[model samples]
Target: MSDLILHHYPMSPFAEKIRAVLGYKQLAYQSVLMPRVMPKPELQALTGGYRRAPVLQIGADVYCDTALICDVLEHRASTPTLYPPAVKGATRIIAQWADTSLFWAAMAYNLSPKGAAALFAGTPEAVAKAFVQDRAAMAVGMTRLRPGDATAAYRSYLRRLANMLSDQPYLLGDAPSLADFSAYHPLWFSRVINPVMADILDATPGLLPWMDSIAAFGHGRPAELSPLDAIAVAAANTPAPLADEPFVDEHGIPLGSRVTVTPEIFGHEATEGELLAATRMHYTLRRQDERAGTLHVHFPRIGYVLRKAEG
Candidate 1:
């Protein structure tokens, strides 16, 4: 198996979720730190424009979106299983909700006036402005929860989580499942990354202790690898064989056609490649980059829109 190379920065909450999963599984991986903002040329080279952070690179295959990344990781390490069989359906649904609704609400509150002030207290004004602008650009068409509304919703959500945890150690059952990781990351930003904004958590009892339990699974052992080196690694190797799943094409598109996959909501960058596989769960596109060689980029079917590339 090729080295598990994770491209991420320290402060990405979704990246934290993957890191924690790696830690829980005790998987050793190579780390490639990405820029906090855009113009991620090296990443774009591999992804063909899909700019999401914490992309999992295994040889020449790149996995985007944490939802699909979680699935890939689960395949790699199954024991401390993220999807327990009994509640698998519930777990996935809850994880989806947490990743979208809970995440945005928590972020809006965490980056409120007071919270943002504390977060960038010592940083230059321009740095803060750039981040805001970058995020605003990503959030162009989406409706964001206002800070006050987010606070209300976040508080309610925390209380509900407290209720869920009152009886069990994890969200679904005795063990931590995908739902816990999904829920933990947003709150992690509030508590771990920007502690000043964590006051929102104070009102909910038992929530902090649950977060502490999740945090104990520190990021697994990581060896740093430079971006150039990571790209060279991709260039040196061919994409591994894909899973043996029958193509489940819903679109009238066929394999070998050129297609573009774009996220339906935020970060609407489009990635164009030759359609390689359209399995029930994911889409695989084969694209070539000068620096990275031929690469296979994969995205989950749920959140992305696939269209045959315009001629």
Candidate 2:
């Protein structure tokens, strides 16, 4: 198997989710740090235009979105499974909610005036402004929860999580599942990234111990890889062959058509390519770049929009 190369930065909550999963599975991987802001030139070479943090690169195959990455990882390493059979359906649903609703509310609260100041403390004013503007551009069409509303919603969500943890060590059962990993990242950001805003967690005492247990699954051993070197690896390798599954086309677009795929909400940059595979769960695009050669970019079916490319 090729090295599980994860392109991510330290502060990405979604990246933290994948890192924790790697740790739980005891898998070793290579880490490629990516820019937190825009103009990720090397990564864009591999992904075409799907610019988001924490892309998983296995040779020439690039897996975007943590949800799809989780599935890929589960396929690679199944022991201490993320999707426990009994709660697989519920686990996936909960994970989706945590990745979207809970994530936004927590981020809104964490990036409030007080929180942002603490977050960017001692950083140059220009750098801080750039970060804010970059995020604003990504959030163009979506509505963000106001800080006050976010605080209220975050508090309520925390309490609900506490209720879920009151009985069991993990959210679904005795062993950690997708639900636990999904729910932990936002709180991980609150508690780890911006400790000043983490006072909110004090209201839900039950969550603290659960968090400690999850945190204990330290990120697995990671050797650093240069971005350019990672790109070269992709250029040298061909993407693995796609499964022989029939296309499940919800859109009028056909398998060989030129198409674009973008996240439906935040980070909506579209990636244009020839549609290669549209399985029940994901969409794959075969795109080429001078630096990265041929690559198959994969995105989860949910939370993403796929459309025919305009001439």
Candidate 3:
């Protein structure tokens, strides 16, 4: 087995989600810090064009999206399962809700005027302005929840989470499952990155204790690895084996054509490469950037759209 390599930056919320999963699985992984903005040359080499944070690298196989990353880790080790057998369906549903709907609402609330001031307090005006511009660009075409609306939603969700915990130690049962990790990351962002916005959490005291429970699982030992080193690792080794699933044609786009995958809402950047595989669950693009030899960038089929790039 190759080393578990993660390409992420500290400030990324989705990255935190995957990091917590790694800790839960007790998996040892190496860390590669990728740039938050463009010119991520090393990452471009491995992923072809996908620039999202916290891409998991197992040898040459680069897995994109926290949802798929979690699945990969779950398959790699099953002792503390993310999806317990009895609640797998329910778990996935809740996990998806947490990652997308709940996440956006929390982030909107967390980055409100007061929260933004706190987050970018010491930074230069230009730095703060540029950061806002970059994120606003990424959220193209999507309706954002206003701060007031987001505050109401965040409060409701936190209270609901508190209700779920009133009965069990975890969301579903005794041990932590996928649902717990998914919910934790967003709230983690509010508490850790923008505590000014997290005051609403006070309404749900039960959640505070649960957050402590989840935080106790430290990120498993992470060896310092640079982006160049991670790309080299992929160039030197074979990507993890792909499952033999048939590709389903949904977009009138078929395999062997050039395609690009981009996030639908936030992080709307596109990753371009040769469309190598489009299974029911994932999209694999074969692209060779000079820094990293031929490497594959894989993204889950959800929360992203795949289309042939305009010539």
Candidate 4:
């Protein structure tokens, strides 16, 4: 296995979730601090076009979407399992809900005028504007919650999470699982990135202690690697062999067919390549770029759409 390389920025909430997981697993990884906004050319070279933050690059395989990335990490470090068998189904279901619904609500509330001001406090006006524009582009096709409505929903969700912790230390149980990490990142943004808006958390007093406990994990050992260097790392290696699972095609697409895999919602950029594998859970594509050489980009089947590339 090539060195684990994470392409992320400092304030990305999803990236923070992955960082916490890495800490819990005590995994050492090299960090590539990617651009927080657009023109992530170096990172895109490996991912084809999937430009989500915190992409996990192992050898020449690029894992997009935190949902799939979490699964990959779980496979790599199975000792402290993210999916406990006792509540495995419940853990995944709640995690999906938290990652999408809870996350969007918290972000809408956190990026309100006041929260945005505080988050970009002291930053150059043009830089802040660029950041706002970039996110707006990503949200174009999605229905965003109004700030007031988002506040209500976020509060309600936080209360629900607090209720789960009535007897347990983490969301699913005494041990932290995927659900806890999914639930913590959005709240982490509110408290850490936009402290001005963190008072919303006070409404759920039980949450503070839980949040502190999760934060105690700390980001695992990370040494910085330049973006260019990270790309070179990809070019220097070949993707690991694909899993020996039977193709479980649902889209009528066969292996070796040229296809495009795109996110169903935000970050609609399509990654086009030859379909390599469509396992029960993920889709892998073989794509090549001059800078990154040949790579295998993988996406979870749940939130992405797979289509044959048009001529």
Candidate with maximal lDDT: 2
Off by over 4 Å in 1: none
Q: Candidate 4 — which residues are off by over 4 angstroms?
A: none
Count of clashing residue pairs in every prediction: 0, 0, 1, 0
Off by over 4 Å in 3: none
lDDT of 1 by residue, 135-239 (tens): 898889999998999999998899889899998989888999999999999999998899998888888768887888888988888999999999999999999
lDDT of 1 at 49: 89
User: Candidates 1 and 2: which is better by lDDT?
Assistant: 2
Tens digit of per-residue lDDT, candidate 2, span 1-311: 33899999999999999999999998889999999999899989999998888899999999999999999999999997999999999999999999999999999999999999999999999999999999999999999999999999999999999999999999999999999999999999999999999999998989999999999999988988999999999989999999898899899889999999999999978999999999899999999999999999999999999999999
My TM-score estimates for the predictions, one after another, are 0.98, 0.99, 0.95, 0.98
Better by TM-score, candidate 4 or 2? 2
* Top candidate by TM-score: 2
Model 4 alpha-carbon miss at residue 41, Å: 0.7
Q: Write the per-residue lDDT of candidate 3 for residues 219-260, one digit (tens) a residue.
A: 877888977778778878765566788988889887889888
Model 1, global lDDT:
0.92
Ranking by lDDT: 2, 4, 1, 3
